[model samples]
Target: MTDAPRPRALGRKSIRPSLVPRDLMGDEELAGVWTAQVITLLPQAFPGVLGESLTGRALQEGVWALRTIDLREFGEGRHRNVDDTPAGGGAGMVLRADIGAKAMAEAVSRARGDVPRLLLSPRGRRFDQAMARDLARRDGVILFCGRFEGVDERLIEQFGLAEVSLGDFVLTGGEIAAQALLDATVRLMPRVLGNHHSAEEESFSSGLLEYPQYTKPAVWEGRAIPEVLLSGHHAKITAWRQAEAERLTKERRPDLWRDHLAKLGRPEEDREL
Candidate 1:
């Protein structure tokens, strides 16, 4: 019998070097790339939503990078099987510990400096905007997209992989969450969004939902833009936005409102919504 084709990918490869077509990006465009290394069963899902709008443009400009390490490449035996029946028996196969560890090792070996490794799972810590901001400041990120019954617990413990969740719910796979997390981080990278202030004013940047915005065609369908916004007075506009943000947070997300109040050192009596 012929040996399995080694399941492709073989090992982690730098995608930034070839992200943009050679003719599309010049030498200077490749410098200071913020790399993201992904280990997944499905490599093609990447740059999915990320390959549009600002993130797409940034990828072409080399503001950041993406590389995929196909997990099957590290599978055992000629057939390249990466999962197996649960040790104690269960509903579905679990990704083999040895296989996961090998894939992670191979990916990390090719990475430079101290890059953070994350595994997307339902049981992990809740991913939030603050976490995205912290990650944006890092040199790069390595993400492992779990599938099936989930990865072996030992692999997570041994590799020090920080499991993270997009929210309380689960996903069919981590590819979408990976795209989301990357989009959140990449947009905050230098020169990615062009306007730094835009990132600051976005939701959760200030522990509150962003204020409502209105634009040209100030009057639309019998509704007018807020008078404060049209007033052309910066101070009043700023005050209005702040108050609106606070009110929305209080009404929609009491948890965030409480946290915001605590941060302000305001007494509980003053924290009434």
Candidate 2:
């Protein structure tokens, strides 16, 4: 007869020896748990907002894991310098290729499975809900948080890192962007959000912005909850939500509206309404 599957272990995984102190480590690694490995100079900046609310709860429960690899630990010399003056006489310093490679090697060694390695940069592909959903479906992710003028081009090419941007703007560093990316991706993981439907109904899940939401005190000030929502008619409520989602998308995000229309095989000009 076939043997029964082995039961998974309970509780946090054991601490692995590292230059990073045990206490500063955000969460203990857990077997089979989805993990985010961040390679950053600011190791202490992690689990910032991620350590609260539903994501935090899920983290403590081992539904997901976070590990920050201190990039400075891989630096060279007595001062532990990770960056150097740019080669072409630029105003800012660039993270040394060697230092980045060392840190990435350490991160890669601890990686569990087919984790997508990403580098946060202003010039990279714009991050969005679709990318977050794609990441949520993966085993985990490895994020290289860039600082200063960014890392050596050779290192980026060497690691084959996919560069991602939070928006069209720039940041002092990638730590914030990394956190934002992680927050968006982690919430989509199973059991991370209290309600599964929350992810399904939220903005961008359907290629359009989410419909407006309202709660109790049915009538507030001068406005009342839309009658259709209060009517308890599921069909009408769904229709109303769809219409609002489309209308909002068309008004605020014409780019998204055009894409949505294209998907429906409708003319982009038909977005007017």
| Clashes per candidate, residues 3 or more apart or on different chains | 0, 0
Candidate 2 lDDT over residue span 33-129, tens digit each: 7889999999889788988898777776567888998998988899999999999797999999999999899888888877999999999999999
Clash count (model 1, backbone only): 0
Off by over 4 Å in 1: 1-32, 270-273
* TM per candidate: 0.87, 0.90
lDDT of each: 0.83, 0.87
- lDDT tens per residue, model 1, 1-273: 996444222123233443447322222323345678889999878778887899888776566777888898888789999999988777988999999998899778867756899999999998999999999888789999999889999999998899999998978888888988999998988878878999999899999999998898989999999988988899999999999999898889988888888899875844466
Cα RMSD, each candidate:
9.2, 5.5
